[model samples]
Target: MPATGRENHTAPKAVYIHIPFCTNKCFYCDFNSYVLKDQPVMDYLRALDREMELTVRETPPGEIKTIFVGGGTPTVLNPQEMEFFLNSVKKNFPNWAEDIEFTMEANPGTTDRDKLAVMKAGGVNRVSFGVQAFQNELLSGIGRIHNTDDVYRSLENARNAGLDNLSIDLMFGLPNQTVEMLDYSVSKALELGLTHYSIYSLKVEENTLFHTLFQKNQLPLPSEEDELKMYQLLMDRMQAAGYKQYEISNFAKPGFESRHNMTYWRNEDYYGLGAGAHGYVNRRRHMNIKGVNPYVEAAMQKLPRLEQFSVPEAEAMEDFVMVGLRMLDGIRSADFAAQFGVSLEETFGRELHKMLSSGLLEEHEDRGGYRLTGKGVVFGNEVFAEFIGVLT
Candidate 1:
């Protein structure tokens, strides 16, 4: 796949590439990732390169505005492997926006100075580190390999490599965590003065170590009230530090909002490549094969799809509302009308009236849309749940 002059401006503008190799799996993670030892790393990268070649031939990309490389810790790749993978991206998706937001996810201890330099030279301008907790005990409790010192060292490496758009993820509601502990974590995180922060509450997903411990009542998670307090404290602290809550769990300095994630909230199209990645484009969604060997074998001959389906119109409309409500700015009524050829009220009048009456939603003061109220923000799952079966 060489650079081409023809540009399909309406094609998918966002790309999500998954690297499924991790040094160790976290206790709470159920994502399709595996331990890196003895894994066929080069074979998988070559297969991903083939997938990209086939993907753009099927749906030629526009001037790509955002490209996100997610993982099992993408920074785990050595400098040589990193260079090859990034070169494959540039070859397939040749037309890039001048100010494209190319981001890679990293684990704190995994990113060294030399690897960070390779990432920057490969056109990665942003990095998001998975610094789940500030406390060493909590970090170990969650099976994270990195400590507080590693977080600072990784951030320094990123900056030294000339990649300054940085973000760190902090978790609340961890096993044996307290509100004060969360407050301390947020305070330490804010002290870094990074460009963005993502604060997430822990969810004990099935098949994870946490879930197994939880089933036996072994995980000492914070109580609901303490978790709620943690959420409130983090929000207040982030606001005081001048970071805007652009989405439910994401906060950023002005103009530092994650454009790649915004593509999902806006219900736009994107290419999902690599093992176990799910992509949405042209109203169709597909998930690639989950196993490394299977994905590599399949991609050499075809798209390596494990499953594919076209989203029904009714479900697409419901998705538009569900994901759009995640952003603080909310969904514009005109955008919905333009996409569906019907007013938002005409399609979801009953549901809208119910939520509006309950005070979970409010009309946008300066825009033609509706946004979540404070109460709605806290109980977002309940609000999003209302849209699911209503469309079906």
Candidate 2:
């Protein structure tokens, strides 16, 4: 109850539940998800329940401050199924914080009045709608079945259900995406009175449709210069709309920053439930089996399809630096020392000094630490790689 640390440390305050069923897979999405035409929805839920039970029995989490049910479109579940899934969550993790920030990811097409009500009743305080873009043409191009109307209707449903903590996701740098189109998407998302927004540039990941198109010389993504302009335009627009850029790709109204995601950025541990879910706790990281059938079978046998590895001290120290730097506030030196029982300089002195000299990172005067500069953010992978060498 006090928390988990040496003297006054606190236990992990976050939870992530993966719902892997979706109506259909998007062309650009490679997340662990499957199409749900005639899939055994109830059976999967039962397996998820078992998985949750087994997880809690192994390592019971403390009072949770945040719970994020992300997915393959969590709203794909029917009202009854949604209720069952959420209730199972409560039953499995009974001791949640009083002001728990419970968020659920909903696809615009699948969310309806009934589903919204069920989610609200199930303790989902925030709903993040995947609204990719405003234009119907772009939506279809991205293999999204929902039209603009579905976005409007879904927001209305959530508002009518008294769920006002809403966030909308948008994308830029898509094939054939223009600055004008990006503006329209941002304007439409603002018109919905969303409290948060997550806008990301498209990355052609391997095995995705976009990758295939790129290999075939058919991908029509924006030029690098245009993509840079789009990023600047979004930052300017969101700032004008009074949204705070809390993390790289996330903006929020005052007090609405994503608490669950902050857990990861802050390098804190949390439990990840369901297939393909990953977790970090007690200096160890693990991942659940990715395939649905394999996950279900493993859980039924009281064996999580999990692979655990102990994070070495040096790696953990560098991890603190890498993940904590993702936040705008940057890392705190004293906190890092307290957590690791070693000074920051003693661990990453050479890499930190080198990066600081290169203008890739700057020292945080208030926190006695370092954070990525604007230049570094553009080339963060390079900056992070330095820490890996330090670990070696």
Candidate 3:
């Protein structure tokens, strides 16, 4: 028996590749991406190839079910760079599932006909564009190089290249953004008639420009009331338009749900390749080196891993409950027992009872285990916080 890219061969069923290069840094972004200026571009690509080769040889993937290329912007890669990167991916983990969902995160202006064509030919079946807002001012405020026109142009280019399993990202709670602005963005997104929509609220994370602005009372973010209204309106509009809120932030048509993302929400193992990428396999988790030069130098011998640790069972169970609870369908009792060889009730009964009593968690009549109720969704952080290290 060999690894079929599943549990059979002790290999992860999913893979995540990181390309940490961007055209320019977004004010709201704090990801591990560097500016694409005077950097060793080809050296990084070759280093990624080296990392992939070393990784798959050691772990020897089974049959990869999903592969996601995420980054500062994977589309920032030129046609040649895109081809080279995808080639390394295929060479290292060749055995793929029949319906492997390959996705790449792209920016609007960076993606052109040639690069998209290269991507489609390189086994990327899905393209998720980062089109946060349709208004030009909003786009400029965020330091995003792409405009509304570029969004239209990029989508047209992606479609013309024969890639229609597409999705676009939207944001709410932006600086100087209004409820009407979110409504306009949603209208434009629905007008595109795409497959999926990932509408996320803006969180002012530390070390980001937005965070600094907030500390100085200069970031003109939407009022908390307005932000919440924006979220509620988005849910209503997407539901009216026939998209399912599959995850907290994601909405998709019936069959067009992001399989690659679901792989993470389901708490499955995945191979993480490239600099600053993270992977969880065989109950151990590790992140690659963040610096480009260090990762490249280290991959010549072994993976440029920054941290690695085996997950304890208690911690693993806590993770399962936290991540699994984010979906619309929620976690199941049967699935819990299958994974942990113990009943869900046996571990989180006290916690479940507490949430249920507070109307934050509800037992699904049809599917069994608990799910977040409508109120629970609003107070998700409160609910999730209770699960961490609960078993301990």
Candidate 4:
């Protein structure tokens, strides 16, 4: 058995493909992506195809359950390029589950009806749009190109093209954003009645424009008190709308959780393809080269790995608790023991006891494992931080 408790020979069921081109970079995004103009799109696609071919030959996949195509903006491809890319995916990883949940990320103004039709025809059943906010002023402040109208039009196009399993991403704690503004965004989002919503708070990541503004004290971010109020209101409103908070930042109707994302939260294995993608399989992890042309050149001859290494068992166990606890279901004792050949109590006894004593964690009522108390959810970072360096 693998360190992850799955059979070492069992093929990975999830795959992540990256498309590095977007129309423009958002102010707060630190993802490995580039603007579309002058990029060698076709050459990059062919390189990706080669990578997939090499990948499957080395680690032949089983019935693929999920494939997530993320990008600077995957939907930026024209129909022809989109068709070619999707066909390459089908050709290389042909054995898909009957109920596979293939998802592609898109920018609102980029996905037209024609492009969406091609996406649906090529086995993409889900589309997650980057509609960061409902307010145009906030959107502009964040360097997003789409207006509120583009969001509606894009959704209409997606539905019209037979892609109904839709999700939109919203952000709070943006510059000059008020609690009232967040409320308005959530209300407008709920009015769409989509199956999933991913609401995130702004983080001033290094290398992003927001981070520079923050350092210069030019970023007009909301106060910490107001941010807390916004989160409280968000949780209350999402629950009131009957959406389940399956993960910290994700809400879904029952049975509509993002299965692709679940693979990550559950600490399972997946293939990561394309420039700057990361993959973990058989207790080993690898990150692809980040630059597009450099990646293309590298993939032409061999696997374009920037770095790959085996994860130490102790570090892996720490990761298991940190990511698994992000989900509302939390980590179970049985699952933990299965992966590491040790009970959770035996491994994380002191940390668990400390959190439980602090009223931050409680044994799940219906489930056997421990979960966060309401207070813990708001302070989840603190709980997760407790586990770090405990094992190592």
Candidate 5:
């Protein structure tokens, strides 16, 4: 079998770089990103390079297995800037594994042929297009500047640039979204025959336009029953079409599961670079400074860390359960013991007994692990909550 992952990590094998520039902010997005019209793009890139230099000097990475460049639309960079940035990444993370899954998040409208070419030459083998909806009006209402036309154009450009590992994002439970509308959108997505698909429910986050509208009863959202129906329909359709539900919201073909995302769910260590990025290493978690100039200036002198804290043992235990349960295969008791040095039953026997008796969890058939039952998936929050604060 190919090397899946190591049980213990001495250094980060996965890396995440954040690009915080976007042409426009989506109404439902609350991520740490900025609109790019008047931002200091070049200076930020230089500072990013400096930060990576300092970080690698302190704690160099192993052969990088995964590198995910997420953004406020990483494809917003021009060809020249993209080339410079990718070169800096190569310089810092010098050693890469044989099967490095280098992914760059792109907005559908931002990636032209030239930009796609730069990304391919820079070692980016996978591209995830943020095509939230296929409907033009819904796209406009959600504050995305791209339409269905740009989605096709961007994918064509990516393919032309020699990239076939492509994925697209879709959102359900959106404003004015009916079950029928979601059905139509899913049908359009499945027709494309992409390797991976991520369908997420919209959450009204604070400081977003959607939140303001929702407060004033201006945002028209699907009813609770309708949203549930959309979720069920999507699960059924994806499974029928032979896409595996590898995670709660992700579906992919065999061997095409997102290695970078699995790193997070498996609680692996990774390096985080750029403004407002978060990372966990050496049993501590850190978030970088959020403001653009502040991060740039700080990176010049030192690492641009705004907050860092050592995770206590009990809290780490809770995090293991919360993060691991997101995977449908669930957490293995032996793997848990290998990481935390305690048996799963000994640590959470009370909680496990309760969850098992209530039919929220059951022993996974092929492995000695516990996974969510069908009812548990719907009420997953309740199950996760039971594990939290139980040990800590």
Candidate 6:
């Protein structure tokens, strides 16, 4: 069970809705998604609606501050299905905040003008296009269905449909990629004049094509030194273009940062609906089952097929430090104290002292909180690992 005596507090401020259907899974992808052929799309949407209904029944919907519809590819759904899903969301959670940040993930090839207009009508104000690269060769190398033309057309379609707040995702260190390729990707993305960007370095996880290539020493990724240089170049270019690096991998025009992701980094409570979605509520963490059919069946019975566990206070403190440090502004000591009812130093003074001594972290003189220095951000995982269980 989750941490007891914490359930009577206010409801969550954010909600993450996962759509698990995709036209085709990319080669280097590991997210919970299924191919569209013969999949029960409508059934899954109904199940998702049921899950939302049950969640609101358990905890009345608070002022929803952010809602992100991510997934296999939200744009894969037909217009009617999209309408059904979005309607379910509005019907179940009617008390959305005035400035709610509603974002939906789209694929370049899947979205059309009509579909985007429907999305805009459904209260979606932001669209994130999955444009892994600007070159067709790189797109094919990564098994993405869309080419450069598709990306340009999609962005234009989004603008034509009146959805202006757009973001594009780019990847670095891809197979057969070079520094020049990365530069081209970023340059082309900027040319689109997007409001936000998420640039991620490829990680070779198990069951991914990249993982197989890595095991065989067949990957054509750039050298580590080159990769680091690429990262620096991206940061410099984005900053020069006036985009703020709110988090390590995300950049946005000032005041256009992603609110849904901020809810996660802030460790605030949120409802995660759909297969393989994770939720943090009432100081407890739960993960829904990853399979689509099982999730649907379980949700149909108004039961979350989830594994629930309470996050220990010590672990929570460590998590707070770890996640909060990911932001450029770093953790707020006052917020930590308020959440834990204990001074920040009282909880992790020794760990902070050790990290400070090692030059991996520095305390802000004016802010009076710890933040990662320039060198610290590169070794952030190392520093966070040290604080994980140091107090316990």
Clashing pairs in 4: none
* C-alpha RMSD for every candidate: 4.1, 2.5, 2.7, 1.3, 2.9, 2.4
Candidate no. 1 TM-score: 0.97
Q: Give the per-residue lDDT of model 6 (tens digit) for 1-392.
A: 22333444689989999999998878889999999889889999999999999989987878999999989998999999999999999999999899999999999999998899889999999999999888899888888999999998999999999989999999988878888888988888888788899998888788887788889998788889888888888888899999999888899999999989998888889999899998888788888888888888899997565797988877777788999888877888877876777788887888889989998889887777988877787777888788766656
Provide the overall lDDT of each model, using Cα atoms, as 2-decimal numbers.
0.93, 0.86, 0.89, 0.95, 0.91, 0.87
Clashes of 5: 0
Tens-digit lDDT string for candidate 1 (92-202): 999999999999999999999999888999899999999999999999999999999999988998899998999999999999899999989998999999999999999
Residue 192 displacement (Å), model 4: 0.2
- Candidate 4: where are CA atoms >4 Å away? 1-7
* lDDT ranking, high to low: 4, 1, 5, 3, 6, 2
lDDT of 4 by residue, 1-392 (tens): 32545444488999999999999999999999999999999999999999999999999999999999998899999999999999999999999999999999999999889999999999999999999899999999999999999999999999999999999999999999999999999999999999999999999999999999999999999999999999999999999999999888999999999999999998989999999999999888999999999999999999999999988889989999999999988889888887877788988999999999998888985778988888888999999999999979
Could you tell me every candidate's TM-score relative to the true structure? 0.97, 0.95, 0.96, 0.98, 0.97, 0.96
Off by over 4 Å in 5: 1-9
Off by over 4 Å in 6: 1-8
lDDT of 4 at 231: 93
Q: In candidate 2, what are the lDDT values of residues 1-392, reduced to their tens digit? A: 32223345345678898989898888899899999888778888889999888877777778989999998988999999999999999998888888999999989999889888988888999999899999999999988999999988889889999999999999999999998889888888887768899998888888788888899999889889988889888988998999988777889999999999999987888888888998877777889998887888788778465697877777777788888887767788888877877778877888889999999899989878888887776667788788874665
Q: Residue-wise lDDT of candidate 3 within 196-299, one digit each (tens)? A: 99999998888888899999999998888998899999999999999999888999999998887877787788899888998988778999999888988898
lDDT value for model 1: 0.93
Tens-digit lDDT track of model 5 for 1-392: 22222334488999999999999999999999999998999999999999999989988888999999998989899999999999999999989999999999999999999899999999999999999888999999999999999999889899999999999999999998889999999999999899999999999999999999999999999999998899999999999999998888899999999999999988878899999999989778999999999999999999999999988878887888888888888888877787777788898999988999999888886878888887777778889999888876
Best by TM-score: 4
For candidate 1, list the clashing residue pairs, or say none. none
Which 10 residues in a row give candidate 4 its minimum summed lDDT?
1-10
Taking all chains together, the TM-score of candidate 2 against the true structure is: 0.95
